[model samples]
Target: MLTYVRWYWPNDDLWNYEELDADRWALRHVELRGSDGVFLAAASLAEVLTARDSGTVGAVAEYERRYGVVPEAPLPPPTDALEPALESVSPGEFERLWRDARRQLEQQTGI
Candidate 1:
């Protein structure tokens, strides 16, 4: 199953989406898809998430070095829904959903 996440920059017209593998709860792809569903640039999810988890400062530096410009806005937290994610959600709602998902996944995988 594929879980889609939409991210909008602070002042940018175009948005990006992260397509994750729901079974493994891992990222699979990232891209800026048009309304007609045309894909723009794509990149490895593991690579991007790894960079993000490392540290914001380091990630910004790496992005700037590679893309020539760092992302000015951070990704907004996901909503509290149990299924498909939303574009905007409260932090509290996101935390609740995250904790539940983590617990359930851990129980199922015993990891």
Candidate 2:
């Protein structure tokens, strides 16, 4: 089966898309292309779908949402050993951290 999504590319303020082919339970492949039908990259199907579902826009928002924003100063890694604990961080805490990290980034980069 094949599916297509109309994707919005904020960089050039243009519309682009991905051609997804599903075979049985998993995706076959994903093709990323520009509005003009030029090939951009061959990306992972799951990764592409996740971004599409997450409504990601812009470089910073995409990175910050997919991966936590980088801190200005080096910070120690958590000492905890459980994966579930990390997943259980409260939504409020997550928002606060993102906001603080973004603010710090803007200050450092003067964006």
Tens-digit lDDT string for candidate 2 (7-36): 344566433222333421213211223455
Full-model lDDT, candidate 1:
0.43
Question: Could you estimate the TM-score for every candidate?
Answer: 0.30, 0.27
lDDT of 2 at 20: 32
Best by lDDT: 1
Error of 2 at 71 (Å): 16
Candidate 2: clashing pairs of residues:
none
lDDT of 1 by residue, 1-111 (tens): 655555543344444544445442434323333454333333444556667788676884553333222223333335434333345434454344444434543454455
Those runs of model 1 whose alpha carbons end farther than 4 Å from true positions after fitting are 23-26, 29-40, 46-77, 80-111
Clashing pairs in 1: none
Q: Top TM-score: which candidate number?
A: 1
